[model samples]
Each structure stands twice: as C-alpha cells, then as structure tokens.
Target chain A: MKSADKHRKIIRAATKVFAKKGFFNARISDIAKEAKVADGTIYLYFKNKFDILISVFEQEIGKLIENILLLLENETDPSAQLEIFIQRHLEEMKKNRNLAEVIHIELRQTNKLIRDYRKNKFSEYLDIIAKIILQGQNEGKFRQDINPDIAKLMLFGTLDEISRLWGPGSEEKVTVEDISRQITAIFKHGMLH
Target chain B: MKSADKHRKIIRAATKVFAKKGFFNARISDIAKEAKVADGTIYLYFKNKFDILISVFEQEIGKLIENILLLLENETDPSAQLEIFIQRHLEEMKKNRNLAEVIHIELRQTNKLIRDYRKNKFSEYLDIIAKIILQGQNEGKFRQDINPDIAKLMLFGTLDEISRLWGPGSEEKVTVEDISRQITAIFKHGMLH
Candidate 1:
C-alpha cells in the first residue's frame, strides 16, 4: 500500500476503535490490529494514541468544512444556504455514526491539547453558521438585532444536542430529514406564531 | 457537625475537587481533605466516588429544577417564563462555575452508570423547557407546528455550548445576561425579519 493509503487506513481504524472502546481505553496496538498493520508501522504514521485521535478529528472535520464550503457556494439565498447546512450536517452524522460518536464524546476531553484543537477546528466549523447569519442580516432577510456569535452557538448547539441521540445501538424514530426540517423551521422563523 | 450539614459540606468540597481535577483524576481522599474530614468519612455519606458525583448533580440540578418551578409560578406568559428560564439557568451556571464544569465535562463520561443518571436528571431539567413550549402552544402564543422535544434540545444545547466557554481561568467579555437575552430572543422571535 502507498503511504497515503496506509495513513488513511489507520485513521479509519482508529475512528472505529475510539468509538467502540473510547479514547482512554483504546490502545495503539488495538488500532494497529484493526488496521492489519504492524504495531511498529503505526508509529511510522503517528506519534501516539493522542496523536491519532487528534488526526481523526483534523481529517474528518477538515473534510466536513471543505464539503460545506463547496455545497454552500451554489446557493445564493442565505435562508436556503442555512437549510442546506443543517440538512448536510445531520445527514453526515447519520451516515457516519462512528465519527459522530468520536467527535461528540471525545471532543469533551479536558486535556489542554484536545481542548485547544477542538477550539480552533470547532470554531472554524461554527464560523460557517455565523457567516450564514451575517449574510442573511446583510441581505435584510435576518433580524439586525441578532448577534451572529450567539446565533451561531444556538444553531450548532441545537444540531449537536440532536446528534447526541443518534448513538450506536439506539433506534431513532425521527428521520434525519425530519430533524433538519424541524431545526431549520425553528431557527429560520421563531417559535412565536 | 450534623449529618445533613456534613453531607452538604462534602458535596461542596467534591465539586471544587472534581472541577479542579477531572473526574478520572480526582480521588476520594482529595475530596475528604478539601472537606476537612477523614477519607473514610466520604464512604459514610456515599458508596464511592461515582456516587458522590451523582449526588452532586442530583442535589444541584434538583435545586435548579425546584427553583425554576417556583420562579415560573409567578408568571403566566410563556414568553416571559422562557426568558426567566434562560436567565435563571445561565445565572446558576455563572454563580456556580465549579458545578458547571463538573456537569458540563463529567456528564460526557462514557460510563453507563453516569450516562443513565445524566439521561434521567438532564431530561427532567430539559422537560422544563418543553413544558414551557407546550404551554405557549396551548395558550395560542407560540407556533403550533413546533415539536417541544426538538425545541427543548435546541434550548438546552445552546445553553450547554455557551457554558463550555465559562470554564475557570477564562474571562468572558459577554455577561451571562447578554447570553440569556440573545438566546431567548433567537428562540422566541428567531432570526428572520
């Protein structure tokens, strides 16, 4: 296998291992075993288990950020852009339960390294929402009084809380589309009649 | 000291210890020392460290639930009740940063016992938000189309994400009141013009 392929294989395996056994319980050897690679070969690609965990987030979230930017480029209306963002976010989590579990659960690790990494990458993801809100305000479609910073938190927080229910072994009665629609409706238009 | 007072004192000390040291790193001896009691005295009030953690949540969150219930009783308008709810929730977190840290970070622990306890107590707290929405719909003040379950998640999730920024040693430029107002406005009136 090429170096790039081997690196990708290890990340994929780590996502599954971390999701299954959690970051603290998961061992580097376990990741190597799952990847069908020698334990020594694992060190060639990554420094340690913490390094692998951070790599998992960096790669997955980087892909998500890139995808959202590409997807949003085609839409002009901020409202529609916001809808697409919610739909895509929920859809991605629904399809990638392991990555979602790893991101949701492990992101809360109290370590300074993970916390700082999360702050930077997570803020970048959240900035997407803030930009949408700012665009809506500029277009005069959204309320001027609303703060983009707080609004972004509200939007991401809602999507995240909803995702917490989508853990493995749990059956969800609501479809991802249902969640996207419900969430978009609430944020686009206030709950007031 | 009275048994009840000693129990309360130990809980207070444990909150500081748990906040300072992540739950995994925190020892019963640390809690006992902080409380100025013998190490064995902790086991007298609780079964183990996990039991103490749960008790802290139960005692603190239980008080929050009780207070919100009492405070909301004075207001009949659902909108006003929601503003009050958001205000009180954020205020409690601001007043009790240690409790906030423990609840915010420790609640995400992957253990089944903590997870189940969190689901139950956290749901009870979130149900307060749902009940407000339900009351608003019944009063014909809020939109009838919204799902209280999803709305509750949005409200709690937003508050939670915001609270994550309020960890110790960090200075927040935005006041708790500013956050509550901003969040309440977005949820109550939304972003759309």
Candidate 2:
C-alpha cells in the first residue's frame, strides 16, 4: 500500500487496539498485529504509541471539523447550522463507537504530554463549536453577552453529556434523536423561561 | 485510633491510592502504608482486594447519597433544591477530590462485576437528578414532556462534563457559576426557547 493508504490503514488498526486495551494498556505490538503491518511499518508513519493515539484522534475529529466547516459554509442560518452540527456529531459517534469510546473514556488516560500535543494539533477542531457560537451571536440568533469560550464549552459539553448519557444500556433508554432535541433547546434558549 | 476511626482512615487511604494508581495498579500494601495500618488490619474489616475497592466506593458515594437525601428532606422548592444541590455537590467533590477522581475516571476499568455493584448500590444517588426533573415537571416548572432518565443523564452528564473540562489548564475557560447557571437553564427550561 502507498504511504497514505498505509497510514490510514495503520490508524484504523491502532484505533481498535486503543479502544480494546485502552491507551495505557495498548502496546504498539498489539497495534501492529491488529493492523496487519510490520512493527517497523507502524513507525514509518508515526513516532510511537502516543503518535498512534494522536493520529487516530486527528483523523476522526479532523474529519468532523472539516465536515462542520463545510456545513457552516453552505448553510448561512446560525440556528440551522448549530442543530445540524450536533446531529452530525451524534451520528458520527453512533457510526464510530470505538472512536467514541477512545475519545470518551481512553484519551483521558494520557498525561500532559499527549493531551498538550492534541491541544496544539487540533485547535481548529476545538474551535468549531466556538466558531458556531460566534456565528449565532453575529447573526443575532444567540445571546450577545455570552462568552464564546464558555459558550463553546456549553455546546460541546451538552453534546458530550448527551453522548455519555447513552451509556452501556442507553440504547434501550433513549435514542440519539431525544438527545439532539435537548441540545437544540439548551443551546438556543438560555435555561430560564 | 478506634476501629471506626481506623476504618475511615483506611477508606481515605484507599481513595488516594485508587485515584492515583487506579484500582488495577493500586495494591493493598500501598493503601495500608498510606493509612498507617498493616496489610492484615485491612483484611480484618474487608474480605479482600475486591471488597476493599467496593468499600471505598460505598463510603465515598454513600455519603453523597445521604447528603442528597438530607437535602431533599429540608429543601422544598425544586429549583432551590437543585441550586443548593449543585453547590453541595461541588463542595463534596472539593472535599474528596481523590474519591471524585476515582468515581469519575478510574472505577470504569473493571468488568461487569464493579459496574453491576455500583448500579445496585448507588441507584438512589443516580436517581436524584431524575427525581429533581420529576419534581420540576409536577410543579410545572420544567417541560411536561421531558423524559426523566434522559433528563437525569443530561443534568449529571453536563455537570460531570464541565468538571472534566476544567482538566489541567482549563482554569480560566469556565467557572462553577457558569456551570450551575447553564445546567439550571438546560434542566429547567431546556435548550429550545
């Protein structure tokens, strides 16, 4: 396989390994075994275990950021754009449960070094929610006094909390639709009547 | 120290060890050393490693439930009750940061055994948020159509997400006031205005 294809292929394998063994327990050998690549081949595209983790996150969340940007670019209305963003996020998690588990549960295990590498590398993805909140405010669709940063946390926090609410047996308790609706409400309307 | 004092001391030590090293990484000897109790003294109160782990969780979250129940008895207004509950919850976590970390981050490493154990044991604390929503709906303060279980998750998950959001360097990004206010809006009136 070409380097790019080989890189994607390795990341796919690494994601599974990280999800299964967690970031702490997962070793590069397990990743190579799962990826069907030589151990050295893994090193060709990445530096180490943390690299594999970061590669996976950058790929998944990068795709999400790119798609959301494309959506916001095409859709001018702030409210519609915000709703679509959250719906897409929930659906994305649904499709990539392993990535969801890794992001939700595992990435947390990484120390300052791993997390800082991520903060710098993925600042764009991190700002997507902040950008949307800004868009809403600019369009006069959201409150003006709200700080974009806290607003960003609120947006992502609501979606994240909703995703988390769908725990092990959450399939039976609630559908993703239910969560999306609540996200729309809390995001648009400030909580009080 | 008396037996009760000794038991509390052991539980406190277990909380720190489990929080720092995680359940799998932490050993009884480490906890015993921290508690100033010999390893054998631990076996006297608890059966084994698993029992100690369970005891640690129970002692920590059990007090949380007790505090919640006590609040319910004294606080009548649903919204007021929620505000105070949030404040107390933050205070409680501040007091037991290690225990909070263990519950939020570490205990999730176990298999079905600990998961089932927690679900059975802390169902009341788990249900407190649901009860708040139900009370709000009955009082006509919250949306009449809200699902209490999902609502419960949204309430707890949002708070939990924000707490985690304050990870290492998220100090200035948000505050407890923002968390409490946003959660109140999301829970009481919901996302949609």
Candidate 3:
C-alpha cells in the first residue's frame, strides 16, 4: 500500500479507538490492531497517540473547513448561508457519529498542547459563525448591536449542545431537519413575539 | 467538627482535587488530604470517587436551582427571568472556578454511571430553561412556535460554551454582566434588525 493510504488507514482506526475508549485509555497498539498494521508500523506515520489525535483534527476539520467554504462560495444571502452552515454541520455529525463523538468528548482535554490546538483550529471553525454574523450586519440583515464574539459562542454552543443529544445511548426523537429549522428560526427571529 | 460539616469539608476537598487532577487521575487520598480527613472517613459518607462526583453535581446544581428559583419568585417578566438566569449562571461559574473546571471538563467522562447521573440531574438543570420558555410562551412574551426542548438546549448550550471561556488559562476579557446582557439581547431580540 502507498504511504499515504497507510496514513489514512491508521487515522480511521484511531478515530474508532478514540471514540470507543477515549484518548487517555486508548493505546497505540489498539489503533494498530484496528488498522491491521504492526505496532512499530504505526510509529512510522505518527509520533504518538496525541500526535494521531491532532492529525485527526487537522485532517478532518481541515476538510470540513474547506468543504464549508466551498459550499458557501456562491451563496450571497447571509441567512441562507447560516442555514446551510447549520444543515451541513448536523449532516456531518450524523453521518460521522464516531468522529462526532471523539470531537465532542475528547476535545475538552485539559492538556496544554490539546488546548492550544483547539484554540487555534477550533477557533477557526467557530470563526465561521462570527463571519456569517458579520456578513449579515454588513448587509443590514442583522442587528447592529450584536456582538459577533458572543453571538458566535451562542450559535456554536447551541449547535454543540444540540448535537450531544445525537450521541450514543441518546433516545432523541427529533429529526435533523426539525432541529435545523428550530435553531434557524430562533436565531434569525428572536424568541420574543 | 459535626458530621454535616465533615461531609461538606470532604466534598469541598474533593472538588479541588478533581478539578486539579481530573477524575481518572485523582485518588481518594488526595481528596482526604485536601479535606484534612482520614481516607476511611471518605468511604463512610460516599461509596467511592464516582459517588463524590455525583454528590458534587447534586449539591452544587441543587443549590443553583434553589437559588435561581428563589431569585425569580418575585419577578413576573419572562424576559427578566431569562436575564436573571444568565446573570446567575455566569456569577456562579465565576465564583466557583474549581467546580466550573470540574463540570466543564470532567462531566464529559464516558462512564455509564456518570452519563446516567448527568441525564437525570443535568436534565433537571436544563429543564429550568425549557420551563422558562414555556412560561414565556404562555404569557405571550415568546413566539408560540418555539420548541421548548430545542430552545432549552440552545440556552443551556450557549451558557455552557460561554462559561468555558472563564476557566483557568483562558484570557477572556469580557465581563459577566456584558456577556449576560449580550446573551439576553440575542435570545430576546435575536440577530435580525
């Protein structure tokens, strides 16, 4: 197999292991076994388990960011853009449940290295929401008084909290479309009558 | 010291230890040392570390619920209720940074026991938000179309995400009042002009 293919295989296996056993409990051997590779071979591609976790974020979130930017490139209406962003986010989480689980639970690690990486990469992902709000304000579609920073946290936090219900063992009955619509409605038009 | 006082002291010590070392790394001795009690005494009031964690949630969140209910007893306005909720949440998190750290990071543990406890106790905490939305709807202050479940998640998630910035090592510059006002404005008036 090509080195690139081997690298991808290891990452996919690591995602599963990390999702099931968590970051601290997961071992490199488990990842290698899942990937059907030798323990030493796993070391060839990544420095350690933390490095693999970092790569998972780098590769997955990098793809997500690129894909989202591409998806939003032609959309001019900020409202439509926000809706698309929400739809895409929910769709991705549903489609990649394991990845979603890892990101949701593991990313909260208190280690400085993980925290620093989250601040950089995760902030970039969150900045997408702020940018959308800024666009809305520039177009006069949103309130001028809205603070993008706080609004970004609200939107992301709402989405993050909502997604937690979709995790394993959760018996959520709401459809993704229903949730997307509810969130969009609330954010686009305040709850106040 | 009295039994109740000793129980309270051990819990306080456990909160500090868990916040510092995390759930998986913290030992009973660490908690005992912090509380200035014998390790055997911990087992007397609690079955194990997990019990202490659950008690932490029960005690802290229970107090939060009672305090908020008391504060809102005299206020008739739903909007004011929400503002008060936001304000109180930020204040509690700020005042109890150790508990905040433990809840923000530790509560995500994948243990079934913790997860079950979270679903029960944490759901009650979140239900407070849903009740506020339902009250607003009944009073004709909020749009009737809003789903209380989704809105509850949004409000709690927003507060949860925002509070994460207040943890140790975070250089967040926004004040609690500023955040409370911003969140209240967005939820009340939304982003739309």
Candidate 4:
C-alpha cells in the first residue's frame, strides 16, 4: 500500500481502539493490532497516540468536509445542499459507529488539551454547517435571526442525541435516511408552527 | 449527620465520581473518600459498585419524580403543568449535573442485565414527562396526533442535549437556564409562524 493508504489504515485502527477501550485505556499495541500494522511501524508515521488521534480527526472529518464542500459547490440550490449534508452526515455515521461514538461521546472525556485541539479543528466543521444555514438564510430558504452558532448546536446536538439513542449499533427502526429526513423537516418546519 | 443524611452524602459523592470518571474508571475508594464514608460501610447499605449506581439513580430521580408528581396533583391547568415540568426538569438537571452525566452518558455503557434494569427504571422517569404530554393532548393544548413516544424523545432529547451543552462544568458558552428558557420559548412559539 502507498504511504497515504498506510496512514489511513493506522487511523482507522486507532479510532476503533480509542473508541472501544477509550483514549486513556487504549494502548498503542491495541491500535497496531486493529490496523494490522507492526507495533513499531506506527512509530514511523506518528509521534504518539495523541498524534494518531489528531490524524484520525483531521483525516476523517477533513475528508468529510472536503467532500461536502465540493458537493456544495456543484449544488446551487440551498435546500439541496442542506439535504445532501444531512443525508451524507447520517450515512457516514451509520457506516462507522465506533468513529461516531468516539467523536461525539468518548472524545469529550479527555482534558483541556485534546478538547482545545478539537475546538480549533471544529471551527471548519462549524463553519461549513454555518455556511449552509447562512446560504439558506441569505436565499430566504431558512429563517433569518437564526444564530448560526446556536443553530449548529441544536442541529448537531439533535443528530448526536438521536444517534446515541440508537446506541452502539442502530437497527432499522430509524435509518440514516430516516434521521436525515426528520432533521431536515425539523430544520425547515421546526417542531411546531 | 444522621445516617439518612450520611447516606445522601455518599450518594452525591458517588454521583460526582461516576460522572467525572465514568462507571468503568471510577473506583469505590474514590466515591467513599468523597462521601467521607468507609469502604466497608458502602456494603452495609448497598451490595457493590453496581448497587451504588442504581441507588443513586433511584434516590435522585425517584425523589424528583415524587416531587413532580405531587406538584402535578395541585396543577390542573395543562399549560401550567407543562411549564412547571420544563422548569423543574431543567432545575433538576442543573442541580444534578453529575447524576445527569452519569445516567445520560455512562449508564448506556453497561451490559445487557443492567441495561434491562435501567430500561425498567427509565420508564418511571419517562412517565413523568409522558403523563404531562398526554394531559396536554387530552386538554387540546397539544396536537393530538403527536405520538407520545416520539414527543417524549423530542422533548427529553432536546432538554438533555441542551443541558449537556449548557452544562455547569462545560466550557460551553451558555447557561442552562438560558438554553432552557430559549428552548421552552422555541417549543411554545417555534422557529416559524
């Protein structure tokens, strides 16, 4: 495999180990096993476990943002862009329960340093969602006076809570498509008139 | 302190430790030290670590339910009852952030047996919120077609997400009461006309 592919393999492994065993409890050995890389091979690519975590965060969420941003560019309709973001977000989450759990649930367990890094990286993530809302508001699709910051929390928090409710593995009672649709409806129409 | 008061102290201490460290990482020694109780003394009142979690859940949530149920008997007006439920639920969550974190975040980490116990105990918790919604629907204050199950999830999920975001220990930007009031206003007036 190419160097980039090897890097991705390491990250995929680290995410699972960190998620299943937690960041503190997860060992480099466990990550190595999950990735199928030699224990020492991990050292060749990253400085430490935290580095792997940062890599995973940047790689996973970065790729996601990049793809969505590309999608936004091609999709001129604001509603269409928003739907695609929601739909794709749910599908990605469904594909990787461990990654989703680690990001939303376990990652918060760490102290200040990791959290600060997350907040910094999360700006782009936040900005993308804010951009969608801004596009909607500007185009008269979504309501004005909706603070993108608070709205992001509601939007993000709703999805996170719903995903958690579905637990470690979601059954078909609520599909990613189902969540995508319901959240889109809520974003558009809200809970009531 | 009286034995009853001492028991309450231990319960609060356990909640704090469990919330901060989570169930798997939190040790009985830490909880006992925080509670100012002997390790063996814990066994006098409860069976084990699992017992402490269940006890904390019962004592805190059970008392809150009793208070709410008693309060509801005097509140015949559906709207007033709804307001009170929201206010008190917010207040309860604020006063018991540790307990909230433990139950909301940690309890889900348990195995099937404990999850079963939690499911049974959780219904009682849900009943408080569900009963109010049912009353509102019957009184023509809320939409009759809204599924009570879905309504509870929406309301509780919204409130829980808000609490975690506006959590007391959170570096998050808002106050619980601010989010609570804003959410309640949104719930009532909604995002659109």
Question: What does candidate 4's lDDT look like per residue over A1-193, in tens digits?
Answer: 3498888889888888876766766799999988898999999999987788788777778877887788788887777777888787777777777667676655455423365776777667767777877877788866665666666666665666556555543344766776677666555554432
Q: What does the lDDT come to for candidate 1? A: 0.85
- Per residue, candidate 1 scores C-alpha lDDT tens digits across A1-193 of 5589999999999999987777877888899999999999988899887899999999998999999999999999999999999999988988897778776667765444576787788789999999999999999999998889888878887887788768754676789888899889888778998
Provide TM-scores for the models: 0.93, 0.84, 0.94, 0.79
Estimate, for each residue in B1-193, the C-alpha lDDT of model 4 and write its tens digit: 2488877888889999988777767899999899888888887777888888888887777888888888889988766676677777777777777767765665545523365665667767776767777877777776564555545555666666556654544676556556666566555544443
TM-score of 2: 0.84
- Cα lDDT, model 4, residue A102: 70
Q: How far in Å is the alpha carbon of B64 misplaced in model 4?
A: 3.3
**lDDT over C-alpha atoms for residue A139 of model 2:** 73
lDDT of 4 at A101: 67
Q: Which structure is stronger by lDDT: 3 or 4?
A: 3
Global lDDT scores for all candidate models: 0.85, 0.70, 0.85, 0.70
Candidate 4's error at B129, in angstroms?
4.1
Q: Candidate 3 on A104-177: residue-level lDDT in tens?
A: 77776534448778878888999998999999999999999888988888898888778877888888887889
lDDT of 1 by residue, B82-148 (tens): 9999999888888898878776767765444476776788789999999999999999999998989
Looking at model 1 chain A, report the run of 10 residues with the lowest lDDT sum.
Answer: A104-113
Ranking the candidates on TM-score from highest down gives 3, 1, 2, 4
Better of 2 and 3 by TM-score: 3
Model 3 spans > 4 angstroms off: A111-113, B38-41
Q: What is the interface RMSD, in angstroms, for predicted model 1?
A: 1.1
